[model samples]
Target: MELSEISKSEIEQEIQQSFEGLVEASKALDATRYFEFIDAERFVGLNADGTNWNSIVGLRELVEPGFNAVEKVESLIFTNVRISVIDLNTAILVNEYEQKILLKGGTHYKEAGGGTQVWSKASGKWLLVSISASSKP
Candidate 1:
């Protein structure tokens, strides 16, 4: 698709939908589905607001433990999102969100946070290139 044909609103909506899909995959403990949206070879993740970024191998390793730790996703909301398209193939997305999760062994918690993600379109598919998220209790 041409950059002139795409609107900022459209990219924003796509990112929002993809983020929700990630949450759903997490809630279901479906690693395969979760990885579908990720660009594993070029992935970079800053999970839980951590300073050090995780590479593809680290990201993969976290899938089982991360989802296994979450029994259910009680609530997941993303808001105040902004999308800036650098080109037809690249965009930067920023957003704030809050989530309530039920963890394994009956632990429950609520977290609020914001994130910045760099998305790239390759072969007509939008793939997550890098992301950094910070959350508070």
Candidate 2:
């Protein structure tokens, strides 16, 4: 589809929903659902751990440990979201996030950061093509 076929608001709404799905899945540590929002075949991203990954397997290995260590999600929220539509097939979203979790060892983990996600609709659906996260706030 062409850019003229879709309004910017529509694209923003789609990306917003996609981001929500990812956050919900992450909060619950549902890897399967979390991966659904990512474009596994052509994914590329810089994780919060400072590791850059070009494949889904790399992502799973780099991030799963923390997910597994979470005993409960105390809070997960995103604020100041900004979305830029590049075309009908692509959009970029940036946001600030705050997350607090209870670990299996009975310690609380808290983090606040700004992140970016590049979303693509090339495969007939919106999926994260790339991601980047900065250090805690």
Candidate 3:
């Protein structure tokens, strides 16, 4: 079904659900599950590290070290989130995030960032296609 066929409210709700899934997987540090929300074949985005990523393999290579080293998620919060439905099959979401994590060896890591993501419906499901994000320690 094309997103254009759905009401804007419905589209927004679908996007919300997808984002919630992403947040859950991220908080659990589940790389495999977390990536399900993305369109791996088409994904091209700016990483938190300020590098452009066009390959999921490269993204995994860069993020797995930190992902694997996390002992626990102390907190992960997205604030001031806003969603916009652009067109049939397209939407955008922007938000600011703060996270505190417990890494291996009991060290804590904190980060703050803002993110803009472009999502499109694929096979009737919303998949993240691109992201532009900024990060700071």
Candidate 4:
């Protein structure tokens, strides 16, 4: 269905569910599952520190290393999520969340902050197009 035909609540709910699936994939360190939710052909991610991934391959490279380095991870917690439709086929989602990571040597760290993501409709599916995010150490 077109974005114009989709209600705001429906979009919000889809975003929430997609976000939850992402968290689950990350917590499981499942690369295959994680990439399934993204728009591989038109994806970009910018870190808070000015780092950027310009393509799906770049995103995968960045994510895999971290997941491989970590021994375990807790599911991310998203809160205060907000979504704004940008146009007939695009929307933006912002939310605050916390992440905990346990490294191979038993080192644990936690971060809290939020991220903004751009979601685009492609072939009748909502796919993540871009993201800008940061969290405190």
Best by TM-score: 2
Regions of model 1 farther than 4 Å from truth: 1-10
TM-score of 3: 0.90
Q: Whole-model lDDT, candidate 2?
A: 0.88
Across residues 6-67, which tens digit of lDDT does each residue of candidate 1 receive?
47667767766877787688667798898887887778878764754567777777667777
Candidate 1, poorest ten consecutive residues by summed lDDT: 1-10
Clashing pairs in 4: none
Compose the digit string of candidate 2's lDDT tens values, residues 37-135.
Answer: 999998988988788887888888866886888899999888678999999889999999888899998999888999899999999999999989887
lDDT of each: 0.78, 0.88, 0.86, 0.81
- Candidate 3 lDDT (Cα, whole model)? 0.86
Using lDDT, rank the candidates from best to worst: 2, 3, 4, 1
lDDT of 2 at 34: 92
Using TM-score as the yardstick, the better of models 1 and 4 is 4
Candidate 4 residue lDDT tens string, 13-132: 777688778778888999888888899989999977778888888788778888889898854677678888766567898989887788899999888988898988874777889989
* Residue 75 displacement in candidate 1 (angstroms): 0.8
Per lDDT, the best of the predicted structures is 2
Q: What is the lDDT of residue 117 in candidate 1?
A: 85
RMSD value for candidate 1: 2.6
Instruction: State model 1's lDDT.
Output: 0.78
**Lowest summed-lDDT stretch of 10 residues in model 2?**
1-10
What is the C-alpha local distance difference test score of candidate 4?
0.81
Pairs of colliding residues, candidate 3 = none
